[model samples]
Target: MPLVAPTTIQKVSGESQVEVPDLLAVEEPLEIRLGFGPTSNRQQKSVSVTMRTPGNDEELAMGFLFTEGIIHQPADIVSCRHCVQDAQKEGNVLRVELHPDVIVDWSRLERNTFTSSSCGLCGKATIEAVRALTPGPLASEFAVDAAILHSLAERVREAQLAFAYTGGIHAAALFDANGKLVLVREDIGRHNALDKLIGAAFWQNWLPMGQFGVFLSGRIGMELVQKSWMAGVPLLAAVGAPSSLAVQMAQEAQMTLAGFVRNERFNLYSEPARVRLAQMV
Candidate 1:
């Protein structure tokens, strides 16, 4: 699917008026569904309707299922496909079939499903609600030099094919402990972008990402910290600042959080020990 759509608009400078064409990042709604049980008595249900940039939706839905605590492991999913008769609605809906033996948590699906591009998590009621979702402490002793950390933004930017075209998408990338780029995913929503990255790792059976670090294109939010923590990603760096709650959560999870990673400098908001300075022999 094309990531950019052209739209015509009028430009005004003082009293002067000019018509021009503008490129917009395509935004569309995706409905995620769940299917379970035997062939004879299967149950299909609606899960969520999220606004996304219209690509890598299977990974998006799977990522949503994992970060939201809906599915525990990849084995819980039997199959995933876009299920719509009309071509117009094909990419808008994705149905994930679960293993017959996997239990479906119906109550978890009763919340609001309309996710805007600005925020993906809808019902985080309180700080406790977020704290309750925290995963165990990360097991990796991964450390990177401050000099290397500041360069992550450029390395991630170099790999963003979609952002280079639209100039309006958020990106999440995974880097190895040595600062090598592993993979990247982009979306109009920050959370969705991270989800797509995580979902790809899950599809490839790369869970418990103890050997990986995350680099986000936007600010560090609590949910982003939470999601990466759940996946056991030990270090997260971003080009923007970290929220108070995000810093707190990262500290609690024993994960390193860095922000303002640009111009050869970065602010370590949590677990500063993970960012090492080069030692002289």
Candidate 2:
């Protein structure tokens, strides 16, 4: 619901008739604020703000924190709430408070000076910067069959209600070990969709998804891979292509990455060993 935006469009007919319809789109903006820990004096000072669709904002904040390695466990987060008490003033701001003993690394916090829905790595200095910040690669103990990967793509597509109505939103979904869809979120920006999904999982105390898989309604990119890895999800499936960097990161992280998932077929990019093709046979 927060993804809707007001826009005017002209519809022209063959003769000369014109019509205008309000357009819906995922909202994007800067949400600058600071993160505080209840017990310690440390806090993320002068954090950059980014605008986003208004729905599931709590999840977005939590997911962002998790992906950025700000907090490892759900318990580390003491609380997350709107920065402003008044609804009218808190339009897009959220404040995340962590437990006092939780580690607050200033060096890592400086990297995220600016963020955008389209590009998650908006403020990084270099490719090396990404490599340096990469979380440990996922352990290769999880098993995900090719059939399950194929099935997940269909499930993600089926869950896309907003796209059905507006034909212009992306979706992100999480599935259990058995490939049953657990949660899903949609937004105009692919990154925001994933963030919302992550936020939802965080709120539900579903971190370190070692036994779960992530499915995306669009292409799998480096940012998507990074988010899944940060959440400890061992597998990622996308309906479209995988960027070259995404493939590289998945391989390095030991995550099972799949793309072009449709109609019972998909391309596996990394950790194919975990995908049992014969399971379908």
> Which numbered prediction scores highest in lDDT against the true structure?
1
Model 2: weakest 10-residue lDDT segment is 114-123
Candidate 2, residues 136-224, lDDT tens digits: the string is 76774777666677777667777887676567888899887677888888877788889888878877777777878888989987778
Ten-residue segment with the worst summed lDDT in candidate 1?
111-120
Tens digits of lDDT, candidate 1, 1-281:
67789889898999999998888889999989899877778998887888999889999998888877778788999999998786888778899999888777665444323222222243234334544555567768888877778788888998988888778999999988688899999999999999999999988888878888899999987778878976778899999998776876788788999999998888897788988887888
**Best TM-score among the predictions, by candidate number:** 1
Q: Positional deviation of 52 in candidate 2, in angstroms?
A: 1.8
lDDT (C-alpha, whole model) for all candidates: 0.82, 0.73
Clash numbers, per candidate = 0, 11
Candidate 1: segments with Cα more than 4 A from true spot: 9-20, 86-88, 108-135, 279-281
